[model samples]
Target: MNIQLNQLIPIPLKEKILQGSSDIWNNNVVISKGDYLKIVAPSGTGKTTLTHILWKLRTDYTGEVQYDGCNINGINAQVMASFRQQKLSVIFQDLRLFGHLTAIENIELSRIKSATPGVGAHEVLEMAETLGVSHILNQKANTCSYGEQQRVAIIRSLVQPFEILVMDEPFSHLDENNTLKAAGLIEKVCKQNNAGFVLMDLDEDSYFEYTHSLKL
Candidate 1:
């Protein structure tokens, strides 16, 4: 139940915005154990870039990012991939699903690749059901509506064994009702798993239930 951003991976920010001279991002934001961190920011505020840096996807950034009190930069690519598969789960705003794969297959594929225990088809299906995606379990990911796909993505993260869940603009594609529904579902799952969650969204009013927040 320990998470840390050590001295390596400094996570410094310059005047780089999506488009601006001023620094939209400040210093590094750390997620402690069992914390649900909601990052509130404007559209082009570099929230996703911060997330990518944290996940080690964009290592060219100026600072260090650590996890579990260890400097992630010291890990090799294979070790980093292993750490990511074992400890981190990310949900992109666009719902990055394999179009040709079934909803369940998308979840199962991650299980197979990572060999993460306890994430079988049945478990994934149950998670999808809890997220109101049972009926579309066998459907192609590309065929489902945006809300359904988003739910599927959430289910994928939930069933996998991960310590951290990173979501970027998770509620952007949903309507009012589905947005509320999805947020509730995500909250329930995170609490049940005792996992840390970092959600980046401009919808400040949407996530008031979060325990804590980090504003960029």
Candidate 2:
């Protein structure tokens, strides 16, 4: 599967984006399977908007976003839900975990939501251990630190099946060491699933051996 952006430009951001140069806005770009892509976006750019567009959470944009040649906007609700369950996953910049839920519960919710079988509870535990978040597995998400919640969100995103994982500033809360640990886990998971990912961030890093690095 591939995500092809055909001259995508957000409606609300049209005037501002038109005044600038970007490889993603108002341009055609293809993100093929197994391609690790890094999008370097400075502040005031539509980095989060691009992530939302790819995830089908935002439609206030011109042009087309296609999945395997089918325009995403044309995908019906039920089928689009299925696509999200089995093919597409995302980690938002906000680390959208349930505040009332335990860290493990948050991750388990995503794991069980998949139409296809995904990581089991034990595997989730292993992932938590790898990310140094195992200690907070039983803690309420609201009480965890930002870095801990971010790691939990990362685990949540990986517990499901996905052909392409779209991430927006997934490591903004973590230190360099934790960021690298999370990246290593993401790389391992992508390779295991033969999956690809598009990571949008503020600056460039030597993360995941990116196949394409673009400015947004």
Candidate 3:
């Protein structure tokens, strides 16, 4: 599977929100399966916006993006939903965990039992433990700290079937150690499935030893 950014540039932004030119917005690109892509941009340069567009969460932009040959702009809601559930999983910047549910329940919600090549409860718990959140598994998501919630969201993303795993500043809440732990788990899972891993961050840190880097 591959995602093609065919002149896939967002519309122009005002000088206030963004200044100067951006390479991503001025070029076409392609990211294939198993590719590790790091999109590094400064704040207010639309890092989240690019991630949303790649995840098909927004369309208030210019150009066409083809996901494995299916034009993203043409897909209906049902198809898009299925695509998201089965082929793409995202760790949104907001974390988006269910506030009322316990951490384990929140992670389990991402599971589709009938979906083959999917992660199991064992793996979910394994990841939670790996990220140092196993002790909080019984706590409600809303009650957990932001860092804890971030780990919960990471585990949740792993429980689903996906060909491309997208992350939007998933490590923003973690320190260097936690970031390494989380990134390690993510890389392990992505390698096992040969899935593409795309992350958008504000700085060009030596994050993940990212195989490719794009500036926005």
Candidate 4:
């Protein structure tokens, strides 16, 4: 599904954002299906806030956000839930995993929630192995290190079926090698599904061959 943003400026950051220039805030922009879009945002620039808004985790913002030409504000909770379960997936910066669940369990939760059939358990294992997190699949999420948790979260997001992926600083805890591995896996998944992604990061990198780049 294509995502359209029209004059979207967070109320909490309005004054500061209005005083500056941005390629996203208060601008008309379209993230079409299968497009790889990168948003470079520095600290205190509402980067996380923007991610939340797009995922419908927050609505305390001005203007409109549309999915496939339908205004998100007009969508009921049931429809929104359907969209999230089938059309959208996200890799949050904070890695919102169930602390009490095992790494594989966390991944399993997402796999079972998809409206479309998700990857099989064997495929999940293959993904974990690719990202070098297979060894920790049985470990509790809270017991894993930050990097391990991040890898688990990435696996969780990928197991689900989605048309568009939204990621926020998804590789902050990894080294160059792991980052590339994770990026490769993400790209492969998106390609296989003919999907798109919106990634917001503090700095720029050659992680993916981005179709568009915007400053926020």
Candidate 5:
């Protein structure tokens, strides 16, 4: 699948935020399948907001956001929801886990409305173990450390099938070694699935060999 943005600009930002080098805030771009892309910007730059818009969580932004050549804004809410469930997965900055539930339970609640087969609980546990958080899976999400919760969020996002995975500061809580581990896991899975990824971060450095980089 390919996402084409044609002069897509976030509204209410023309007067507030200063423009960047390529005018990405008000310009055009393409995110193709198998593309590994990064969005690097400082705080308050709408990195999270952009991801939300891509996944239909927000409608305040202006201009066209096309999914596989179809105008996303033209679709009804039901169809949009279906599109996200089947084709998009996201690791939100806030983690968005059910804090009262066990990590495994929280991970298991991922939307599996896609045509592809859903991941089993054992596979979810394996992903947690790979990220070094298997033991914590039985614990309540709120009781786990921030890093452990982040790993839980990663597992939750990965268990579903997707064409595009959006990560908003996904490794903010991890050290270099753990960050490398998480990135490697994402790379391996994305390659296997032939899915593209869009990662938003604070700096230019990235663990994956990115196909493209842009500033907000």
Candidate 6:
């Protein structure tokens, strides 16, 4: 499960933009197996940029992101998309979902489209039940409460057979109670799947109980 970043894809920056810049991420950052890594930073601190670089979306950057000793920058878009679909899952703070689809339908969509095995409608329903969203499964995503939609989004991530879960400020919209519940669900899913997680957030305290922290 070793993840490495290698090679370099130079990104040109205007002189004005680099006027006072002294720090740049040019080297590889290795994330070990079964580790829960936290990337903490304030808003606009390049956390999302780093995530995109690692996930092979921002290939114009000055470095390459490798996973399990292979440089992914050389891979094609379809390969990268397949990797993202099967082995890597992302949960955004906005909780991206289809407005017309039901909570269960959202999860089921991921299962149906995924190349990984062991995920289906039954599994999606079970995950939703575990996250306390069984009652809202049939409800449209746009009609559900924010907290419920958040849980649904998380369950969608769980339904994928991802070895690495990259979450960007997933708990920002939840109340105190739902935050705890979501954290618990995240921990349960990660442990059950033996998956490593990369959580990006400014509030490290909220995730302290679920995973170790690493400030970037």
Candidate 1 lDDT (Cα, whole model)? 0.70
- Model 6, position 70, has a per-residue lDDT of 74
Clashing pairs in 5: none
Off by over 4 Å in 3: 12-19
> Top lDDT: which candidate number?
4
Model 5 over residues 32-139: C-alpha lDDT tens digits?
878899989789878888888787777787778899889887888888777667777889999999999999888777834465634666777678878999898889
Model 2 stretches astray by more than 4 angstroms: none
TM-score of each: 0.82, 0.97, 0.92, 0.98, 0.92, 0.81
Q: Is candidate 4 or candidate 6 better by TM-score?
A: 4
Ranking by lDDT: 4, 2, 3, 5, 6, 1
lDDT comparison, 2 vs 4, better candidate: 4
lDDT score for residue 16 of model 3: 30
lDDT of 3 at 55: 82
Residues 116-187 of candidate 4 have per-residue lDDT tens digits of 655778999999999999899999999999999999999999998889999999999999999999999999
Best by TM-score: 4
Any idea what lDDT model 5 has? 0.82
- Residue-level lDDT of model 1, residues 101-191, one tens digit each, is 9998887767666775535667666666666789998999999998888888877766666777888887776777766777776677667
Residue pairs whose backbone atoms clash in candidate 2? none
Worst 10-residue lDDT window, candidate 6 = 14-23
For candidate 3, the TM-score is 0.92
Query: Least lDDT summed over 10 consecutive residues: which range in candidate 2?
Result: 112-121
Displacement of residue 216 (Cα, Å) in model 2 is: 0.6
Q: All predictions: root-mean-square deviation over Cα?
A: 3.6, 1.0, 2.0, 0.9, 1.8, 3.4
Q: Which parts of model 4 have CA positions greater than 4 angstroms off? A: none
**Once superposed on the true structure, which residue ranges of model 5 sit more than 4 Å away at CA?**
17-23, 111-115
Rank order (by TM-score, best first): 4, 2, 3, 5, 1, 6
Model 3, span 1-216: residue lDDT tens? 788887555665534334466667746888888788988888878888888888887887767888888889898888888877888889999998889999988887788533563786688878887899999999999999999999899888877888888889999999899999998998888887778888989888775767899887
Q: What does candidate 2's lDDT look like per residue over 52-93, in tens digits?
A: 899888999999999999999889998898888888889999
